[model samples]
Target chain A: MTRHRAAATLMPLMSLALAGLLVVAVLDLPPQSGLAEPVAGAMDRAGVDHPVTAVLLNFRAYDTFLELAVLLLAVLAVWSLGRRDPIPARPVQGPVLHGTLRHLIPVAVVTGGYLVWVGSSDSGGAFQGGAVLGAAGVMLMLSRPRELPMLPAPLQRLGLALGVCVFLAVGTAGLLAGHGFMGYPPDWAYPLILGIELVAALSIALTLVLLFLGGRHGH
Target chain B: MATDPVNLQIYLACGALLFVMGVHALVVRRHLLLKILAINIMGSGIFMVLLGVAAGGEGGVDPVPHALVITGIVVALSATAVALVLMLRVKAATGLARLPRSGPED
Candidate 1:
């Protein structure tokens, strides 16, 4: 008991010390001009009108590509663990949930699409759109008392792999054209970024739903 | 940037404090779920710091950091999903939601 109490106290003390150091660090940080100016200067060359979108899809495509891979890797890891256990009990569905979902899913789908389309010039983007679509998928899953049907195995694999595959293909095409890897030709940047975002959003939505489902549906 | 310096300072302080609290919870809590949540809190703190700094710069908010934080958020979500599944597997295998305590003191 004494040891436990001692550990508890020691842990808080350590945390406090760490907190103080972090505050000091924050206070000590040097202020300077930021990359905003540089990004703005490059905006004409960048495909997207929104600075954040340009940075994400053009200036730093590599990061976004790797992020997609990470999402895919996560689902792969989950699938490897085991088949998911079924929900313990099914609560009888109320008409309210059914009615809500009936109205909600179509709205979510349209909103998600609009977000992806507007992302090049506004706050909405692939990730935000993907999240909305994913939430709709989760709602659909919850609404169904029975096991939700899985996509055919091949199609499922293709959907899961779509984002990375399309991204790599585009990058490879860029490489072949001598714009360097992940680079789009000056005129082609807008369309390519938009296309990639669309596919990526679709893949992200699928990945999130699969993650929520918690394991692979056994073949 | 047009952002207020005082507000920036407050945000940075809050971020640092949040990170500290997350560390504290991670250490003191034994539930695997709480540990996962604490780690997420830590990530949120880092995001807050990034945004605060992004706003502190002159001219405009830095788009690079905004992009980085978005990437970070997606990565964090992916990580959390995997961690939750792993926790469920652990619970099934060990019959405990908390990890087995192991220490010289124990």
Candidate 2:
């Protein structure tokens, strides 16, 4: 009873302390007057409509490209980790869960595609979509681990390389168009963004799924 | 009080809450999956803050931060994938779900 009383008292005190700290922190923040106005104004002056996509594929194309490379490296790391290991048998779990997951997989795949498509103008995007699709693979592993497909080494490499290849190819195309590396030829900007995003979505989803599988074959 | 900065305050507060929750999760959760989720939450918190700052106490939101967050989401997933693989291997090797501990052993 005494310990319970103490715990009850401590909880409120902790909560109060946290609230006070939050209030102080909020108060300390700069007044929201003149933060990103200049940058927004500049974007307006430059006539860079669809600034979000423009910034993604044009202004910061190199960063996005490197990000794809980073994902590829991650896939490679997972592959190396599981190398030379014999595939293990799947764990035995219940049937209801398995059936439910099977149903969910197709829904997830469709949702992922939708996200990639709508990402052009909306909050959703390739990464979000890719992650959702990757979750489907996780579901497969969890529900029917025995049925997991073996990702051949070559295909694994291809999955990892797909995004980077698309990004680099587009960058190269831009260079040939006299726009220099990673520059978007003004007319092709939307199409290139769409293409890069689509490929990146697939590559990212595959890499994530493979990671969950530990790059191993199911025995 | 009607300067109408409520939206800004709310966003900033949400960001702070997310950051704090993420920190708590990182410290307390032993599961690798939970840890990765915590990290993503932290990234999202930072993203919110960036967007809030970019909002600039005005109507138009900044596109730069939106773009940055998009890139960040991808990077976060990449890291998550690698971490999940490592966790699976660890689970396979140790038959334990949590991280390995360093201690004086027999």
Provide per-model DockQ scores. Answer: 0.66, 0.35
TM-scores of the candidates in the order shown: 0.95, 0.72
Q: Which candidate is the best by DockQ?
A: 1
DockQ score for model 2, please?
Answer: 0.35
**Candidate 2: misplaced stretches above 4 Å?**
A1-27, A31-50, A83-103, A144-148, B1-4, B24-41, B84-106
Best candidate according to lDDT: 1
Tens digits of per-residue lDDT, candidate 1, A22-77, equal 98899677776589999999999888899999999998898899999999999999
Worst-scoring 10-residue span by lDDT in model 1 chain A: A82-91
* lDDT of each residue in A11-59, candidate 2, tens digit only: 5566456645764686358755342455555443222345565566667
List TM-scores of chain B, every candidate: 0.93, 0.83
**Fnat across every predicted model, in order:** 0.79, 0.44
Candidate 2 lDDT, tens digit per residue, B1-106?
A: 2234678778777887777677666755667788888998988988887776667555466677777877787778778867877777788789976866432221
lDDT of 1: 0.88
Q: How close is candidate 1 to the true structure, as a TM-score?
A: 0.95
Candidate 1, DockQ to 2 decimals?
A: 0.66
